[model samples]
Target chain A: MTPITADATSLFDKLWQARLIKDLGDDRGLIHIDRHLLHDLSSPQAFAGLRQAGRPVRTPALQVAVPDHIVDTMPGRGDATVRGGADMIVALRRNAVENGLRLFDIGDPRQGIVHVVAAEQGIVLPGMTVVCGDSHTCTLGALGCWAFGIGTSEVEHVLATQTLVIRKPSSMRIRVEGRRGAGVTAKDLALGIIRAIGINAAKGGVLEYAGPAVTALSMEERFTLCNMGIEASARSAIIAPDETTFAYVRDHCGSPEWLPVATEAWTMLRSGPQASFDREFHFNCTDLAPQISWGTNPGQTIGIGDAIPPLPEPSAPRERASAERALAYMGLAPGQRLEGLPIAKVFIGSCTNSRISDLAAAARIVRGRHVAPGVRALVVPGSSRVKAEAEHLGLDRIFIDAGFEWRESGCSMCVGMNADRVAAGERCVSTSNRNFEGRQGPGARTHLASPATAAASAIAGHIADCRQVAGR
Target chain B: MKAFRKVTGTGVPLGRSDIDTDAIIPQQWLITTSREGLGKGLFSNWRYRDDAFTPDHGFVLNEPRFARAKILVAGPNYGCGSSREHAVWAHLDFGIEAIIAESFGPIFRDNALRNGLPAITLDGAAVSQVLAQLAALPANRMTVDLERAEVTGPDGTAYRFTMDEERRRALLDGIDDISATLAHAPDIDAFHSADRIRNPYYWVQPPRD
Candidate 1:
């Protein structure tokens, strides 16, 4: 148990203190949200509540707005280019400007998915509280911030007061030790964690990710880890910011004359070597392989070479009957091998893995290979900026040359908010998080994997190991 | 806000499942976080494309019979996608009060319940039967009783279903989750006051196994 703050603390204390979590009493902990990011999805209601209350925003500067979904992420464009999607994004800009909030509208060079851009810009500092309407807000926790998703009304409350009345969550520390294999990426690690802990099992719990393997990850990788915490039903996922974090922030946000002062403050952000949690889970990444979800939930996953888990024995008939129903609904056979499952589509984009590094990995796999005949492979960047960077590096050409559709960013196909979608009954190897039934599109079957695996599956037209491919 | 003891509407015929937020209200309309005047953008793309409803013949909202639909009868696995609360708001603005589907996405269901939208799921075949019954009649009338959790169709036939009791109570009381949680504020405050003990050295060292 961590000590509660000696002084009366603000609602956002843990973030301001650079502490993982100080006890807030009972099972709750006082954590902070460093940055409050907004998107079109949850902002409207929040703003509505503020209007109803006749309250003015306490600190608009701390709140930022970006539009990544419900807009077209087409190549060389922003939300404005996507027909009417621009109108909403533009409205956010107007609201931001009028309310004195920071706005990153479509076409802004810095714009992308809220989470991706937050890390890349160094806006997500360690020991900060970051809240957003999007569940993937946990992505910022990788930078050592306590970021998570909130409801629309909660957003309104935070905007009006620059504070949140939150219940302290129980803490759960998950430590992954050892080094990873060449093909095993942060995505695989996340998938592995989800598989170990069933979805919704981590509900109301704060998950702190640590250990040597976590320390070795880049800021991008940490983002991947924290992003999936929501899928596990965890309140938040955090990793203590280290030199790599400091370096990334300095490189992107810039280290100025006041850097030394900020650094001194940042040094105190880590867990004081003695921090404890309510629960702990450990993993040895040395033998971890690229992972994929074969069933309806992220927890129902198997390693690259492993087979799907056979139906578990429920103590009674009714519970066993439900398990059978789940298997049937998921269209999976107990003990069936997960590899070589035929796939019709491959999607690589989402806040989960749409960064430049994610694209680079896919580009490597598709460099000299063509997508399997009859397969539809689409690569949607997380934001316009990511698309631009990928094009700058000619990643679009590589994907297109390999017969994959290099389309716009936005949350395409990841959640079926845009035009991109999987046909009914189609099986897709996707880089997006979540393998929930019909999540991508109605009646579509989703197999969650890393970008490399998705790209490799596109080439092989089946679930294949990315490392087995030539050159990559 | 006037209390709606009874909700009545014409059911729209839509067979598509997992109708995500993007399809409900495309990203193009999400620019302003303002909740005002969202009715026009609701189903904007599907309503008008190329100055004509693209796939005009098959688009559910374009059907002449259900032109003023206020209740949507959809297939299984409805509302599967990003947990944007906007989708529910768009539906409500478009005059939707009750959604009858085979099943619903968890987050979307929660959002709808919070906003007084009733997301009721039934057996897929049962929903198809209700849709067929509605389709068989021209300009069918549908009535949903919030207090009873029942839907009456054109022929005065009633379809009964279940809703999460907790959500039903909140909706009946017109309280969102935030308000519901706030109701326990005094209790939560007491918990904090009574449980302020802390560990001395957990921040710097791992806890003992």
Candidate 2:
């Protein structure tokens, strides 16, 4: 083990120090926001607040707005398909035009999920502070940025001042050593970590993912891993930029005059050789299995082959009671196998697992097989660009031939705010982030899994392991 | 937003861990652009049954004893998922002015405070004690005093909690966060100028038509 210096500072500290605009006494600091990403669901209130206050966006050039969350994901959908969402979509466009900010409307080639678009278009950069009205803003932290979600009030604050008054979060480092097993994806690694540590393990702390396993993951995988940081109650999640990160940014951001200088600076954005964190956790993913959430919370997950464990005799009465409640809500008995559990639908999309790589992985599984009878499967790309790329690679043909509904790019079933939703009393295997009760729809049972698992389960009509189904 | 110096109400003991935002306000209720009429959707999944919207007999909030409670005492990590301010709006619409929990999700806590609803965090023992006391005497009221940073049970047992002084003051005075952030305009200008020079590509604009 390498010994850290007394002055060693984690990458989070460096980013924080760089963005600190003013020390507002106490633990609060006014931090400059380099990029502000907005979506239709949460930004309307912020825009209304700004209007009520008679204020204008302080730095319109730094902000970008998109309509993703509540937009319909059907093939021939338009803004009106969002049913009760027309007002929000119209409001977002009106606000962006009024403020002179960039608005990526429904047919724009650059439009996509806010986080995905930010990364793909180089709107989010290393060593910068980014924020969004959505919680999954932390997804951009995979690019070595200090990004996190804010409430509508804070969103208005950032819009009016291009800065936020925030208290510094404590720092924690999660180190995943050893190599991951075959067929294991970043989604499995994230679920495994959340299971080992309870949902609140990193409460109010910034988590920096390190070690060999994390470094070995591709940029898409890193986004998937960090997208769920909020699930663990983390303030933010980040990974230091490396060669893989540089390559991805270069390929996507295009050739700008500042490319050489920016690339050189990004190399220095990583932690020191012996950086120290306030708290450290180490997990070895050598023999880890594909993970699946059995209950409501993301923490209620287990490896694919593992049977559901019985609720423990919690030391606190509240824990015991809540565990029983979750069990009842999930309609699962103790020691039930997650495998062979009948599923009604399968959805493959979200900021978490809707990248092109995720599509390819699922396509590989469903290439020769078809969705089972009585099962409804849907594949939604994260962005229009990703959708175009997947179509170019013929991934859409593979999915459509397999009886999966290939849809337009948007949040889609992940949030259930649009036309896409799971029916009441239905069970769905999803690649989206959260598995909270009624998240997909009222009385809709959601099982969070990786894209491969969701694809394989669509073919099997049950919760099936991708490893066995794909013969990996 | 309502100013919050102190609030006195019966504590509805949710006693459920990781009660997420989705469970608080389901996605179906998120369609409306306005925040009005969200109170009816609060805990709709657990509070109501069937399309008729009949109150569920087993839900804590629907229980006759806690039907009108204005303060919620929940288990650890309450409001754990999503950054939906509608969750906070639902609580406020339902007349909940404060939430006492062992811990809270970072975004949820911020949303609560921004809406002038205090999210008070106490240790596990203190929360457990409060829940137990509330269960024993359903009619007993709990008082949260932001001025003193304390929560008092009906039995006169007081628990001390800590919050950032700035947020505490903001909730007490109903300070708008946007105005507070704008107060540091000069500092923001200084940082932005330097940052723009340091990373020009990020600030560059495409040619306008």
The 0-to-1 C-alpha lDDT of every candidate, in the order given, reads: 0.71, 0.87
**Candidate 2 per-residue C-alpha lDDT over A397-452 given as tens digits, one digit per residue, 9 for 90 to 100:** 99999999999989999998888989877889999988887888877888999999
- The DockQ values of the predictions, listed in order, are 0.11, 0.67
| A1-472 per-residue lDDT for model 1 (tens digits) | 9976554322223453433334434333333233688876677667767667676765665677887766665566655443455555666676688788777777677677888877776566666678887767878888777787766766765676444544456677788998899889999999988877656546446788888999999888888888888776666788877898888777765565545656666666665545666677888889889998876666667889888776667654323453465466567788888688888999998889999999998899899889998899999887667788899999888999899888766777876645677766788999988665446655578899999999889999999998888654
> Could you tell me how far off, in angstroms, the CA of residue B89 lies in candidate 2 after the best superposition?
1.2
lDDT of 1: 0.71
lDDT of each residue in B1-209, candidate 2, tens digit only: 67899989778887778888888898878887787899999999888887689989988888877888889999888888889999999999999989999999889999999899999999988888888888887456989999999999868898899998888988889887776667777888888888788777667753220
- Candidate 1, residue A469: how far the Cα is off, in Å: 0.9
The fraction of reference interface contacts (C-alpha pairs within 8 A across chains A and B) present in each candidate is: 0.16, 0.78
Clashing pairs in 2: none
> Top DockQ: which candidate number?
2
Off by over 4 Å in 2: A1-7, A314-316, B206-209
lDDT tens readout by residue for model 1, B1-209: 12344678788877654455555765545545466566666666567654343535556777777778888888655664456677777888888888888866545665677677888877766787788887787757888787887888777878787865655666777764444344444544443333222211111111110
Model 2 compared with the native: what TM-score?
0.97
